[model samples]
Target: MLRIADKTFNSRLLLGSGKFASPQLMQQAVAASNCQLVTLALKRLELDKPQDDLLSPLKAMNVQLLPNTSGAKTAKEAVFAAELAREALQTHWLKLEIHPDARYLMPDPIETLLAAEQLVKRGFVVLPYCSADPVLCKRLEQVGCAAVMPLGAAIGSNQGLQTRAMLEIIIEQATVPVIIDAGLGAPSHAAAAMELGAAAVLVNTAIASSDNPVAMAHAFALAVEAGHSAFTAGLAHHNNQAIASSPFTDFLAAL
Candidate 1:
């Protein structure tokens, strides 16, 4: 089980509600994944359009909603977005994403840190989406962050753990949950992250854009479980010299 803040989750795979063809399909994908926590971007919601009904479908599934400040560019903007989401969504959980650059959408570390400190003070469960910087993760944990979501690659890039070395450092250092978010394109990537000791992984575009979203979601779910099991069961280290699995003494004596 993955425990973050006060909640304990059975599933380690967190799904994003974006890029899917429709809300129904999104729901189907999420159900197939069996994820307990689902991320929703505040900016993407058509709140003014009642027909959109994004929250309704999510609520129907009885999953925890993780609202994100996806478009915020600064500390002040992200805090404001978080407050709005709290009131609108009626949840204290917030995903802090402050990216000033539109082209790359790379998180601004300075702004993210500033925002995280303030959000923690305001009594919100802050989960900052940050770069795979081990130093930054330690700082965030010091400031009372519920968890740190370090990106494996650029958001929605599906690059799959480009920053593996750095992420391993963060996972080793973090006292809070280290959720591998962003850029996981396939189930194998998710499994690799779990095997590397990540508490969870957040996937978006890859699963949503797959030819069969439901099947892909199921695959990811299985991958995460298998990887976590491997981690718990203990994996063997690589060795240059081969070791025989079976004892050769009996065979040699018989011969």
Candidate 2:
């Protein structure tokens, strides 16, 4: 039962609503995932319409909406986008992402930190996605972000946890929740991350792009549970010694 802002979440895993073949599939997947929080890219929305098709379906899911500034290239632009999302969605929760260079779709650390600070001050729950840079994560934390979202790999690449080592650092050092975002392609990858003690993982492409989204969502739900349980139970550390399963001291006495 982790509480972020005012919301209580039983499952730490967060699902993103993108790339699903249809809105009906998306709704079913969201239900199967049992993920209370879902991210939506602001760029995909046509807010000018009186009634938003995407937002309408997503609202029906009843999950907490986390609007993301995916296409914003500057801090100012990201701020504006977040504001609009709030107006449309009627929620202040936002995923702050600003990448000037769209080639790799990497987050601009400077712009991210700047936008996060501003967003935090504006009564928005800012969760800024960033590189696996530990220092930048700390900087974002200082601005009082709700959580730190660091990419596992390039967005939509399906490479999966490329920043494993860096993520470990971020998880270990972060005061707020550390959510691994992007490039997770399977349930096992999500499970491995939870086993590594990440507070949560934000998955979009992997689940949405799956052949059977409903099954995939259920698979991820189970995997996240398994990983979180392992983390809480404290998995045994590997040892160099090859100890016998039988009682060594009793065997020695018998010998």
Best by lDDT: 1
lDDT of each: 0.93, 0.88
Each model's backbone clash number: 0, 0
> What lDDT tens digits, residue by residue, belong to model 2 across residues 1-255?
757767789988798888899878888898899888988876553668664376666667677888899889999999999999899688899999998887789999988998999999999999998999999999999999998999999888888889999998988898988888988889999898899888888888888999998899999989988998999999998989996887666656766
Deviation in Å, model 2, residue 204 alpha carbon: 1.0
Name model 2 segments beyond 4 Å from true: 44-52, 246-255
Question: Relative to the unseen true structure, what is the C-alpha lDDT of residue 165 in candidate 1, on a scale of 0 to 100?
Answer: 100
Off-target runs (Cα >4 Å) in candidate 1 are 44-50, 246-255
lDDT of 2: 0.88
- Superposed on all Cα atoms, the candidates' RMSDs to the truth, in angstroms, are 2.1, 2.9
TM-score of each: 0.94, 0.91
